[model samples]
Target chain A: MKLSKLAMVTVAAAMVGGTPALADLVFPSLSYRTGPYAAGGIPFADGYADYFTLLNERDGGINGVEARVLECETGYNTQKGVECYESTKGEGSLLYQPLSTGITYQLIPKATADGIPVHSMGYGRTSAANGKIFSHVFNYPGTYWDAASIIVNHILDENGGDVKGKKIALVYHNSAYGKEPIRTLEELAKKHGYELTLIPVDHPGQEQKSQWLQIRRERPDYVLMWGWGVMNQVAIKEAANIRFPMENFIGVWWSASENDVLPAGEGANGYKAVTFHGVGSDFPVFDDIKKHVVDTGKAAGAGDQIGTVLYNRGLYAAMLAAEAARTAQALHNTKDLTPAQMRDGMEALKIDAARLEELGLPGFGPEINVSCENHGGPGLGAIQQWNASDGTWTLINDFGPADRAVIDPLIMEDSLAFAKENNIPERCN
Target chain B: MSPDFLNFIETVLNGLMTGVMYSLVALGFVLIFKASGIFNFAQGVMALFAALTLVGLQTGQVPFAHLINAVLGTDVHHWGPGLPTVLAILVTMLVMIALAFLIEKVVLKHLVNQEPIILFMATIGLAYFLEGTGDLMWGADVKALDVGLPSGGSFWWEDVTRNWAPAGSDYFGMYIDTLDVSAAIIAVVLVVALTLFSQYTATGRALRAVADDHQAALSVGISLRSIWVIVWSIAGFVALVAGIMWGAKSGVQFSLSLIALKALPVLILGGFTSIPGAIVGGLIIGVGEKLAEAYVGPLVGGAVENWFAYMVALAFLLFRPQGLYGEKIIERI
Candidate 1:
């Protein structure tokens, strides 16, 4: 009942997964390129399509097989996302990047049943980091909780390692996506003895006058935002309107897109956000994409979006998926991979700094290894500051590691609760 | 005044300003519902389409950039130098008028005397069609609509109110977005214009006659088709002004349509058929939600603004279902 991905998902899903042999490695992009969230979706989808297109053009595809990328627009609606997943699961599907937490939640069960893998990536089911419970689902690099913990760690570092009396306000999106960090933030707030204010802005957060007014009244020491789409722009403007220190605000990665900042114009300067990968269009991997994909006029989206934050994240996600498919190919020693083979390949995945350097994505990621026991890799992150003078983002700090001590317990607790309720047996570590 | 009292006054002011925005959209709803007895669910989408058209025109962006590029294999995002804001608005108005005629000719004419629910459903379909058309024409990317309207908080207002802070208290001066103040003025002017148009003009009289009794008005030499077209055109104008204001405030995007949802509680509270009801209902909901969110919301962990309006409208319905200014429902069975 969430949304209709329509008749397309079934037809696509029917084609690839149910078959034994397929020429190309097929993956479905549960994209929302036309909605309130299209600003975020368009860039990510473009990056995704481009990076894979680069693979086909530059490297002749992953492991000598041209990757077949199909996109079904979800409008960020879960039903549509599920439709995309179900429809494309049959097209010799390797994996899914639902890109939405809600859709990932729905697909986790179905993907397990179908033996196809679901990669929620950075945005969904933080607890799916528990590979034992979510065998076919992967949320690697980091989870929202990992993100929340990194922000907290950064705050602790910012405060000269003491935050006993400071007040922190979390202005969040009021959905599952926004609520992801609340539990972890509360835990950190108690541990650090910092006062915490939780303010939830309803979706499409255009009107946040009252919320900013409250912040003005309370005057918290720091404010963290978990906003997306129009919410990010509105919140930034409101914060500036109320004279809230832009430097003090740290947004979730979703809030760190150019569309978010560009709408507010100069007011977006000095604002900061956490990112799992590097921001800016300066990555060398993008050169290969330009030379092979955009320059060749084969890019799936606007060539201008080649190096934006969300675009890079999309590129990064696609790279991971391609690598996973290659991993599966190498393990099975077969050019044609079944969904089960793809899952095994994804589980054995490893990407280090050297590998990243080899791939022209130096410093774009940290060492990442997914195992049967832990789907999430060493969840690494970095803080980036928006420099409006030049309209570019500068990474202000080296990539910080997500605090597993804080996140691991929550992941274990949630995944165990999920397993017990669903009668799922734990996988051997 | 104490800091607490100053904050309360400012919150109240914010609520009233927000009420003006809600009222603007609700006014469009009232005009159509009063004239045709059809609750136009497509009103919000109309506003969204209007805003997208304005931005598209303002930037000299080529319409159907995606489709044209796909079909012709040519990349052209803009045509030439952008139009003046005034010129773009004028062109957008003509487009809206054409849209009104198209809607009447294509959809509304066939359902001349249908049940209100069926008409409502038809408007919903119209909403979907217009929404898709808007995206297809404008491209789905978020567009910043800047016609050079002043935004951000009013420093003069803040400075003027600075003395109202209570002694030895944490008090920041009142903050208000200038756009909201302009919107308030525009809303008032719009109401005044509509009031005059409806009261004195010959076309206005015919419009009222149709609302009073469709068959009687038709018999008295007024063409129903013309009236329907005129009313829809007026609604389109209202939608255009609303679209410009909102698009200027927060870049033109898909979320522009959801503002129509806010107008609903205003409609229910003010009575669907009453023009003044749209304003009064918007104010009540706006002020009530703000107060509740500021005071009662904290008790419930905040975010009561989303539902408090509907709750108020629901309660109002129990006492007076016709709405605050709507005509009394009469039964003759």
Candidate 2:
């Protein structure tokens, strides 16, 4: 009877074109590998899949339970993202990493209702970091608000702790992701005594003649950007064209990829961006990925994306999820885990300096400690500058702290408002 | 000059340059519409594909490397050293010409004598197919197009204009991109070349005959299929030039296709049947939108440029449906 059941299971799996077995841990990657933003999305998806492949190959499927990445293309469309989520959530999907902020916003409430944890990483609704209100969503390691605060702190450090009467301009993509830092920056402006200018770039951001011309006319002391995909590249080129001092212009983490800078050639030199993790292929984990995944012909997409900025971010996200799963396994003492179990694992997860060192990434990222109340980790980040000649990004500072004094109240206000509107009861006791 | 006046002058100059860029894409649309009367929605995608092909050839990247690797489990990215920029461009032009032939034979040929809307739908389908095929041929990474085009601000112009302002004024200098200037020059050259060809060449006369009336031209010795292939090939070459300029400016990527939308207002303003109309319309829309965004956007929360062109087009549509230079429409009672 057992032999016949095994045969029947194998046949069923074969009939499905060799889909992952139902028993494996499922991580659905809602990726956009086509459309305007595909330049950024392709590497990220490759990195996400390759990291999971590494876990399965090198570690024998995360402590004897295999992991499967079910990727669905969203083309960066929010509607398609929801469809991908709905389609893949039934495959025992433990977590979701919807890279697009728009898709993450759409998936937050639905994934919450479905009891699936979403890890938005560096991008998403800022208030989702307040785990008390957003129970199933986590934007750990850093949030947009945290990045905003961190950038302000860096600027303050550069200016000898004073920016009174200084004009600081923000050139942002006119979307939810771009609008995220406005409130925080306004608050920071009130505290620091700097004049604020807001410039919104529409989707795709291919043309910015008027905005850059305005920048030239106004001549602000510094510029901050919240852009993604083609917007980043175009903005950098335009900034270079207007002779905007490259060092004075900084981008959010999403805007700091190789794809963004490489298009500008030497013009992108000295461009700075906030980063939560280390860049390049100097990390030891890439060695194992090469041995087990790329060389073995099990890599995702093209193998050329192993060391890119977004790729590293995707790998970092997968690393966090795997660590959380291992933590859940230890807590429950079981190899087979459910979605709820995965949520519990993510909540109780902690990665310290020692743990990072052991994971073959000694200084790859900040120490993440997720909890019931604080889902956004320590909110730490650093600055990375582009060296156009060598085609490399050098981290300019160590992981510094975000201004929690200003950030916490705003988070509280936003989370409480969200809780009241959604009628969600605060969870963590 | 007053600082405010200098700023206005700067804005206008930049707008004109931006308009020239829009006109480059609009010319392709005008060519197809003038000849075939099919609103080729795929013009933007054609530019994107042409640019992608140029970059792929320049970098010597193996076509369909991803698909091949997936199916055969083989790692093959590049065959050998890349071709020179000029050689790659020539090869890309040939590829685009071949693509034009294939499109005429496979898509446009079957839809002959069909309604304009049907042909338009076919072009839409062709656009999507071409976009997908381009992605498969060249990986979707953003590749920098280096045709040795000098970009950044014109320092000489800036230095000359810096002293135009009063001694105490905060205005540093007028900002103008050298690449935009190059694009303007190239666009003028393209327009002149197109005009000379249409006026002097036999094929160009044949093209003009078809544009006058497709059925009438078919009644004569003109082969409508051959005219389409030729016009499309010319449009394809125009797309290659536009793609190179744009791809150089913003890097060759998918958003290059969205530029076709920017040309829509130009088409509406400049009658779609006139090449010079496209250029003039592009300039009007470009300057009008830039000035609107600069002077009025701040008062109304900014980002008005994205919609300002459409508003101008809408006004033109309501007042003069045929546009500034479009052939006057006369309907029989």
**Pick by DockQ: which candidate is best?**
2
Say which docking band candidate 1 falls in.
Answer: medium
Model 1 lDDT tens row, B1-333: 888888898899999998898999999999999989999999998999999999899889899887887688788888988889999999999999999899889988999888999999999999989998998889776677787778888999988888787655666688888988989999999999888998999999999999888999989899988888999999999998888787766678888888898899999999988889999898988898899889998999888897998999999999999988899979899
Worst 10 residues of 1 chain B by lDDT: B163-172
lDDT of 2 by residue, A244-318 (tens): 899999999999999999998888999999999998999889999999999888888768888889899989999
TM-score of chain A, model number 1: 0.94
Provide the overall lDDT of each model, using Cα atoms, as 2-decimal numbers. Answer: 0.87, 0.92
> Which segments of candidate 2 are over 4 A away from where they belong?
A1-22, B72-74
Candidate 1 residue runs with Cα over 4 Å from true position: A1-22
Candidate 2 lDDT over B1-333, as tens digits, reads 998899899999999999999999999999999999989999999999999999898889999998998888787899878899999989999998999899999999998889999999999999899999999989889999988888998999999999999998786888889999999999999999999999999999999999998888889889999999999999999999999988988899998999999999999999999999999999999899899999899999888887999999999999999999999879999
My TM-score estimates for the predictions, one after another, are 0.95, 0.96
Q: Model 1, DockQ value? A: 0.55
lDDT of residue A44 for candidate 2: 88
